[model samples]
Target: MSSPTTPVRRRCTLVAPGSDERKIAKALESAADEVVLDLEDAVTSARKDEARALVCRTIRELRTGRSISVRVNGLGTEWARDDLRTVGALDGVGIVLPKVDTADDLITADRLLAELGSTARLQALVETPQGVRSIDEICSATGRLEAVVIGYADLGAALGRVGGYTAERWLHVQDRILIAARAAGIQAIDGPHLSILDDAGFRAAAQWTRDLGFDGKWVIHPGQIDATTEIFTPTSAAVEHARRVLDAMAEAETTGAGAAQLDGHMLDEAVAVAARRVLAQTGG
Candidate 1:
C-alpha cells in the first residue's frame, strides 16, 4: 500500500474541449481546482490534431495555479501515441488517460512521461468493464498515479444502461473504485452529472457521492463548478467541530484515556481520524 499523505484539495475539475480556446480560457479563469483540456470525446476526428496543438500551446502559456490536465485520446487510437509524446513533454501539465483497462496502460503512460522528462502526475479514467475490474492494479500501477476518475457515462453504456443516473446500478462500482483509490492513497473522483441544467439533481448527486467518501467531482460546465466545490468543501461549522474534536482527543490523551466524549457523542481514534481528514481538507 502507498504511504498515506494529506490529500490534495481538488473539489472541482472542469472539462473543456481542446478545440475551443474560448472555453479553455474561461476555464482557466474559473474557480475550478483543475481544468482538463479534452482531446477525446470532445473533439472530432478531423480536428484531433488541431485540438492537440491548441492544448499544448494553452498549457505552455496559461499561468493558472490550479492543475491543468490534458485528456488524451485512448490507447489503440491513431493519435494516442502522438498525444502522449507531445503533450506529455510540456511542463506543468498532467495527463488524464481515458479507457484505461489495466496496469500496463498506466505503466506505459508513466514510461512515456519519464522518457519525455515530464514530472506531471497521472489521472486514470476507469470507463470500461475491464477497467473497473482491474481498478486495483491500475491504482497501484505507478507512484505517479495521483487520481482515478470514474467515467460514469461510458461505464453506463458499457453496462447497457441508458439515460439516467441510477444509484442501484452504480453504487457497487463506485464503492469498488473508491476502495481501490483509498487503498493506494490516491484521489477518487466522481464523474460528471449530465443534467447540467438540473441544479437540484446535480446537488443531490454531488451530496450523495461526497457522503460516500469521494474526494472530488468533475464539472462539465462553469456553472457547475461553484456547486461542486461547495458540496465537496467542508463547511465552516464542520471545520470548527473538527477542531474541537481534535482538542478533546488531545485532552483525553493527556488524561491517559483511550477515548472521550465530545458533546454527547463518544469520540475515539476512528472519530479522530475522520475529524483530522475534515480539517485537512478544509486547510483548517
Candidate 2:
C-alpha cells in the first residue's frame, strides 16, 4: 500500500481518455496540476482492453510535472481487477476508483493494491446514491484514500436531477461531501463542468465549489483550466488579509491577550487557523 501524503494541488485536474494517445499527449502538455488517464466511463467496453494497454504504456513512458492518476473501472465491473493489477504496480500513481459506494469497495481495492506490492494511492469518485449516502465511511475507509471526488454527471443522473447546472440542486450532496472529506482530512474535488463552451457557467461553478472549500475541480477540456486555477487560487487581497490576521493575533499573543482586533473585527486563535490555511493554500 502507498503511504498517504499531502495531496498535490489539483486546481485543474485534466482527464484524457486512455484510448486516445493524441489526447493523452495533449493533456500532459496542458500543465494542469493533475492529469488523470481515464479507463472507466471514458472508454467503451469493446476498447477497454486496448485502452488498458495504452494507459499502462503511457503511464510508464510519460514524464511530466503534474501528478498522475488513473480512473479505474468500478469495483463491481469485470474490468476493475485487470485495471488495478496493471496500473496498481506503477509506483506513485494515484488510483481513482469510480462509483465507489461503500467502505468495502475501498477496502477491497486497498487489499488488491497491497497484494500487488504497489505504491499507489486511492481517490474515491462518489457518483451513486449509495456512494453519497455512505460518504463518511468511504472517506475514512482506507489509508490509501487521498481524495473524495464528486462525479456530478453520474450522481445527478442517479439522483434523477434534471435540467442545467444549479448550485442549489447539488448543495446538500456537495455539503455532505465537503463535511465528510474534511472529517477524513482528504482533498474534496468538484466534478467536471460539462458545458465546455459556456465559459460563464464554468467560472460560476468553479467559484461556487472553491467557496465551498473544494481543493480543486475536474476539467474535461483544457479550455476550462485557466478559469479553474483563477477561481481556486487565493487572491492577492485575500492573502494579504490572511497575513494581517496572523500578524495581529501574534501581537496579541505576545501581549498575553487571547484575542485582538483586526480591521474592526475580532481576531482570535480560530481566526489565525483560517488565516494559516489561506496561506498554506497559496504556499505562502
Candidate 3:
C-alpha cells in the first residue's frame, strides 16, 4: 500500500490541569485535536465554581477557537446542577460527564440540552464499577452521546484495583468500553498516562492506546501532542503502500481479475476496503 504526505488531526488532545481558562485557546492550537477545560479532578472543591464559570465563559466567548470539551463535576458533586446548566448553554461544547454509571445520567443531561436549545454533543467518562457493568446501556443513553472516554485514574480507585505502569490491569475494561463505543458508532478516547515528565513513557502509552483501537487519548501536557500525532497518523511509507494497493486493486478490477497482490501478499476485499478508507481519510 502507498502512503500519503498530507497531515491530518491526530487522535489526542491536551487538557489543562484545571479550567484555568487563561491559556486554553493557545494550547488547543499548540497541537491537539481537542482541548478539554476540566472542572473535575483538576479543580479543587473550593474552586469548582471558579472553574465552572471559566469553562462556561471560554465556551461562549472563545467560540472561534479549536475543539473545546468540558469534563464536568461527577454525579455526586454539589456543583453538577449549575455546571450542567451553565455549560449546556454554550453552542458546540462537547460535554464529558464524569463517573457515569447509568443511562439516566445521559438522559438527564440530554433533557437539559434540549430545554436549553443547545446542539452540543455528550461524551461519557465510564469510570465506575457500575459504569463498566452498564457499559452497553450507557452507550445507548442519548442521541447526544458521541464518545466514550476511559478515565482509568478514577476507575481503578473505584474498582479497588491497584494502578500499574503498562495498563495491563485495565485491558479488559478498555476492551469492553471500546466494544460499547463502536457499537454506538462513537469515538473512544483512552485515559491519560500519569507520568508527566517522561516523554518516552507517554509515547509508549499513546502507542499502547492506539494499538488498543482507541481513536484518541486523554493528554495532560503540550509535549504529548507530537507523540500523539506520531502514533495516530499513518507514516508516508504506509500511506504510499495504501495508495499502491488501491491502484493495483483498481487495475485488477479493470482486467476482471478476482483479486490482486501487493508485495507478494494476496489482497482481498477487506484489505482493499481498509486501504481505500485510509487513503480517502488522509487525502492520499
| TM-score for each predicted model, relative to the true structure | 0.90, 0.90, 0.82
Query: How many Å off is the CA of 241 in candidate 3?
Result: 5.1
lDDT of 3 at 157: 80
What lDDT does the true structure give each of the candidates? 0.87, 0.87, 0.76
For model 2, the local distance difference test gives 0.87
Off by over 4 Å in 3: 1-10, 23-26, 240-284
Query: What TM-score would candidate 3 get against the native?
Result: 0.82
lDDT of 1 by residue, 114-136 (tens): 88887777899999999999999
TM-score of 2: 0.90
Instruction: Tell me the tens digit of each residue's lDDT in model 3 across 61-146.
Output: 65665677788887677888788888877766677899898999888888877888887778888888999999998888887777
Q: Give candidate 2 regions above 4 Å deviation.
A: 1-4, 244-269
Error of 2 at 247 (Å): 5.3
